[model samples]
Target: MAGKSIIDVLENIPREVIYTIVLIAMILPLLRPLGLPVPVSEPIKKWYDAIESLPPGSLVLISHCNLGAYPAFDSMQVATLHHLFSRPVKLVFFSIDATGLVVYDTLLSKVDPKAYGKVYGVDYFHIGYIPGGETAMKALAEDFKAAVPSDYKGTPIDQIPMAKDIKDIRDFTMIICFTSAGETSIGWIRQWIVVRPEIKYLCCVLDMMLPTMRPYYEAGQVAALTGSAPGGEYEFLIGKPGSGIKKADAFTGAQLILLVFIIIGNIASIAKRMGKGGVR
Candidate 1:
């Protein structure tokens, strides 16, 4: 029997070794983030631009419904909130999903508005969790104060000072929502968007739901619609490193390692085929 050639030896490399290499690639970044470059996509650019275009004293209504995940809700939520608070925009936050209340607290704890020199009731305030899913959106759209007469903590809407003039749905320069629920996300378009054609809506939803909501973005009904896939790109654009960068590094590292292995395997296969033929 003929001894193995170089191609044969290469093709016979152990699968366990490849798996171990990929595992190591993913883990090393989590321990110490490599600060790898994450390219910004067009949608992410649109999202950032929408926020950046906000003029001073621009009112932005914020909504989020995210049950926390390590890098899912963590990256975009923290980074975007930091960007929003850094500016001079006035924000009003509310939650449609009941579970999102917890996310609100956790999110705020990480990026405190006060730290950005924002006063709670005036610059930003949470309206807490409004129970009715789509119905709440409709009511809030038609009558901002009638829907919720008080702030999240039961403070009267009139007392907040900033929220006092939200008499019209068109009052806000934009409405930003980070959501996982199809109802709340799509509901924003149906309820508020349809009624007020001019209001810009920025949506950051779960990546899995991107395809379902992408039509709106393409049609231009949604100012910007996206998910957390390129969250590291967003962080870099905003100049804050968080879970996005770490997550991107881990996944990219594993992928690059696997890609190298796949390329090697294909080359070995071609070499073996040529060696058996009269070609080489």
Candidate 2:
């Protein structure tokens, strides 16, 4: 009865309908759980199998590229870290973003307080926050001690038992960057991967950015890329849906609902347009 066009009313209807559809999409997948078989890519499979093959006490470098408004990137990073840590890998935490320290500290506390408690410096260490974006990373590749004199806790690197003999980046086996930005990933590749071709690099990147980073993947510069929530969820469904996977499913459902709404709106728009044009 209102003067509003039929298209407008139809669009509005679909908007509400979409909410219900999204709920169904999410609830269904979560409840029924597709149990989709994970077709492991060679790179991802290599990274997984390689980490799993680590001799129980191998050290892994975990880099929080930067802090974000949402914890999606952080969640993905932590999920992968959890996977490795769950396998009992020794890890060291460092952040390129100053804001990341807060999130990292909070995440570490919730994920594994006991495992973290066991190896403060020996098995696990937080190098804390560092300065100088790419420049700092470049310096670290050459001489880590010169770049960061002390860990995030202000403990002198010389004092930490594990860091005593570790003078540079080469000390670690792999460099794992959980980042969304190009600079962070590229920096690692330029400073470490390019310089130290023998060392491995894996990225836990956000979903939208996956396409952008695909070139690196094709170039074989990145050893592995854990794509968005699908990657996280696949890992989870395989025995792991980390928060990344859970959030990914939610993201997928949201997109589906949006698409349905768009379709419905177009249909209503056509109907209204013809009605206004003398029922042609």
Listed per candidate, the RMSD to the true structure in angstroms reads: 4.6, 4.0
Stretches off by above 4 angstroms in model 2 are: 1-5, 8-47, 55-57, 116-118, 231-242, 265-280
> Candidate 2, after superposition: displacement of residue 129 in Å?
1.3
Model 1: worst 10 consecutive residues (lDDT sum): 271-280
Misplaced by over 4 Å in model 1 are 1-25, 68-71, 254-280
Winner by TM-score:
1
Clash count per candidate: 0, 4
Per-residue accuracy of model 2 over 1-280 as CA lDDT, tens digit each: 3576555666567445667887888787666555544455555666576676666766678887555633666455555666676666677788888887887777776578466345678777888777787888888778878887888889998898877767777777788887767788778888888888777788767767788788987898887876545455435534655654545555666677778777877877777667752331
Clashes in predicted model 1: 0
lDDT at 54, model 2: 68
Candidate 1 has what TM-score? 0.81
lDDT tens string, model 1, 119-210? 98889988878888889988888888998888878998889988888886878789898887788788989998888878899998888899
For model 2, where is the 10-residue window of minimal lDDT? 229-238
